[model samples]
Target: MRLVIAKCSVDYVGRLKAHLPLAVRLLVLKADGSVLVHSDGGSYKPLNWMSPPANMRTLSPDDVDLETGVVEQWIVQSAKTDDRLIINIYEHISDSSHDLGVDPGLIKDGVEADLQRLLAAQIDLLGDGYTLIRREYFTAIGPVDILARDAKGATVAIELKRRGDIDGVEQLTRYLELLNRDPLLAPVRGIFAAQQIKPQARVLATDRGIECKTLDYDAMRGVDDSETRLF
Candidate 1:
């Protein structure tokens, strides 16, 4: 990763126009060729960012840009789309690079992981006669949160999220696409389960023919309590 703190201005041109006036900000260049411009505040969301499958190049300031006290510029262009982000650096404050090798990715924790475990044990939450095959079912892309079979014995891929958003739907869609390719799981269907699902996510999931299930964490735990053994 490369981190640059400088006095700069940013402009984005693509599906829409956005501009960040001259100010000091942090420019993050990731190993995946993505770029993010961040201010001091505002949680983790960057002020502006270009997703991966993009390119970044540093160019010397042109005469016109030099007149404005610009010393250098970085052009970030999307490889899959026409999106572009241009950063004009007037004064460089600091720049550094770190050799942070391959990331292990995020670690699931808290209520989310616990919810998965509970749901796996109580697969009937999905529907009558639903039986869980496994949790964290492996896939070439990643692991499906839960794999199960419905009442009619149809393979079902369940993606559990704390908050169901469009991204979660996209994730389940990818898993279903891959799983359905296998003759063994050829007819796999998708169920997007979450504690709270956004309206947009529900619409997207419905449009994609994926079932949207709102999970009741407390109620599920209550059901588990009733089924617990004292032995």
Candidate 2:
């Protein structure tokens, strides 16, 4: 990973367009080929970013750019789309790089942990011929709940939740974004599994091309009726 604090202006072009005026900002260049622009505010979300499957090229400023004070430029092109992010650097501050290895993923609480176990055992619930690759498929960002292969052998990342919400969908989206960086899983699909799913979450998941499944906890636990099991 590379981190640089610089005074730069940015512009994004593709399906939509946006611009960020010159200012001091943190630029993150991840090992997975993603680039993120962040400011001191906005918490953890990047002010602007380009996901993986991208390539970045640095070019010296041209004559016109020289008039505007652009010393250099970084052009990040997305391989999956026509989207591109252009950063025109005016001043350099600090730069550093680090090799952060794969993350072990977040520790699960009891219910989510139990849910993961149940879903992994009944991987077929996803579909016919689905096979479990493994649980806790670790990536640089975090671990996937359960990695599996579909009938066609494509990769699927299952995100288990006790109660599915829009937040879970966002979390799964992040995982999918990072997972797709791997050539072995370039076109990974996502499954948002939970005992209960909110309406908004379903809509967002569908929009993002993610499949949703509601788990019958009692059935998975071998209880004939849900009433027979105590919370």
Candidate 3:
């Protein structure tokens, strides 16, 4: 059976009124479902709430299938059958150069372009049928930093950590767990890409059977890309 995910569109103008990045809070099969999300690195403590289409009914937390994990279900059902999965677990838009700099759109475009190029260069390295999907996709599993597909159509989730943190590894682990149990996308592999990696994070990934990789990028430097090889 083919699965399809509808494009998510929140009433940005009429609602929240804040530029908080729109995120896929949670994944539920029923039309009437609630999404749960919280601030990053904050003391929010993962609060779950009900927020769905007005016409749709509210679904209990148990209504969501934990089999595939919430994030995987959301992603698989949200994208078109032929579309690839590209996730960005941590996303931020700032008018400063500390991060990707101002212009969220520009940052998004640049990152997407680089990923496309990287995939193209390693076409042979990557399994067949692999394709570049979306850019800066904010999902319930944090930001789906980057999710790819293999020749067999299995997902390869990528998590990018700008700065190393124990939470980053835990978050990615959660995503992997979700994907592993998902019947629709079982056997999905995972990749952990980061600018800097914590020692503990490294050990955690190795213990969990994930391929932890290091990605190097010159910060605020105008360079075509000094180097981006994975470790």
Candidate 4:
């Protein structure tokens, strides 16, 4: 990944239009061909971004841009569409790249791991016709708990928690954002499931268009089943 801290302005042209006035921001160019513009605020979400497998080209500032103090500009064009993220650089504070070798993927504790296994085995619990794509689906960021397809064949990212909270929702949101970048999964939806969910978390999940589901551990463990009963 290449990380650049610079003072620059940004613009997006395609599907919709957006503009970010001159400011210092963290621009991340991931190995996966994802370009993200992030500010000090907004926590983990990027201010602007171009998803993979897009290509980037650097162009010298034109007459008007040079007059505006732009040193150079980067044109990041999406391969799937005409959407573009343009960055006009005025000053550079720092720039560096790193080789973050193979990732080991995220690890979960015993309960979380078991829950993941159970869910993957009985994915139908998610919904009728829900099919499991894979578990621990890795992306540029981290491993998604579960990746599946709904009955309609729409991609769905499921984040599991023993106790669901706002943080869990935010994590799922980031995963969804990255997954939707892939043309194969451009319209990824999210499901936040846990044994117990806080009220605030549920509200936030609903507001963010994520579906919240409550897990029943006892039922999944088959505690009520005669087959598991002891005389």
**Candidate 4 accuracy as TM-score:** 0.51
**Global Cα RMSD, each model:** 9.7, 15.3, 22.0, 16.2
* Candidate 2 ranges with C-alpha deviation above 4 Å: 1-110, 225-231
- Give the lowest summed-lDDT range of ten residues in model 4: 59-68
Better of 1 and 3 by TM-score: 1
Better of 3 and 4 by lDDT: 4
Ranking by TM-score: 1, 4, 2, 3
Query: Best by lDDT, which number?
Result: 2
Model 3: lDDT equals 0.49
lDDT of 3 by residue, 1-231 (tens): 111222222222222232333463322222343233343445655322234432222222365543332222232111213221222222222212122234445334335346434534453334457765544445555556566776777678777656656777788788878767778666877777666788888888888887776654442223544556353
TM-score of each: 0.51, 0.50, 0.39, 0.51
Per-residue accuracy of model 4 over 133-201 as CA lDDT, tens digit each: 999999999999999999999999999999999999999999998888899897999999998999999
Higher TM-score: candidate 1 or 4? Answer: 1
Q: How displaced is residue 110 in candidate 2, in Å?
A: 6.9
Model 2, global lDDT: 0.93
Give per-residue CA lDDT, model 1, range 21-140, as digits (tens). 999999999898889999999999999999999988878855344546889988899999899998999999999999999889998543679889989999998889999899999999
Candidate 1, residue 127: how far the Cα is off, in Å: 22
lDDT values, one for every candidate: 0.91, 0.93, 0.49, 0.91
